[model samples]
Target: MKNKRLIQKRRELKLTQKQVALAIEISQSMLSLAESGDRTLDDANKIKLAKFYRVTVEWLFFEEFYD
Candidate 1:
């Protein structure tokens, strides 16, 4: 639920889970876990994701976008 936007943004960038994982210094399994809503991102990961996506942290987590 919370990370749905992250998934969308990644897809929009044409990036695979492995690619994003590498960018965030995480493993593919961890990325998969986050995408599946099985886990939440820690503070470090939140920062990494925000930087990697070039979006604000609030935007990454809370902004709604049209599909």
Candidate 2:
């Protein structure tokens, strides 16, 4: 799922939750919730994260769920 992928990519990039939150202009709590699958990202944020990770939006948003 997107949540798992987000967490995975965050780890791969060696980004602390605070670092990822700051880069994405979100709060650390929000990022934590997102990684735990307690919340879903807004479309704009999905796009931003995709770009940050150099991944296609499809890969970031729907890869695990859809494919």
Candidate 3:
């Protein structure tokens, strides 16, 4: 469940966990957990992240379907 796509997107955007977290108003630790798959992002946060990354929520979270 590790959100490797999320991590990849962040790296592609040249952003750090802290930067993304601050932009989305979440804690860095929470972002870390999401990226690491230790926790799942809530629906609202998932939408926020998708918007922040300029990606569709499906692309961000359900890449298998895209494949």
Q: In terms of TM-score, which candidate is strongest?
A: 3
Worst 10 residues of 3 by lDDT: 58-67
Give the alpha carbon lDDT tens digit for every residue of 1-67 in model 2.
2377788898999989899889979889887887787888788888888888888778776756565
lDDT (Cα, tens digit) per residue for candidate 3, span 1-67: 7888999999999999999999999999999999998998899999999999999999998878887
TM-score of 1: 0.83
True lDDT of residue 47, candidate 2: 85
Per-residue lDDT of 8-35 in model 1, one digit per residue for the tens? Answer: 8899999999999988789999888888
Select the stronger candidate by lDDT from 2 and 3: 3
lDDT of 3 at 35: 92
lDDT at residue 27 of model 3 (Cα atoms): 94
lDDT of 2 at 36: 80
Candidate 3 off by > 4 Å: none
Which residue pairs clash within candidate 3? none
Candidate 1 local Cα displacement, residue 36, angstroms: 1.4
* Candidates arranged by TM-score, highest first: 3, 1, 2
Best by lDDT: 3
Candidate 2 weakest ten by summed lDDT? 58-67
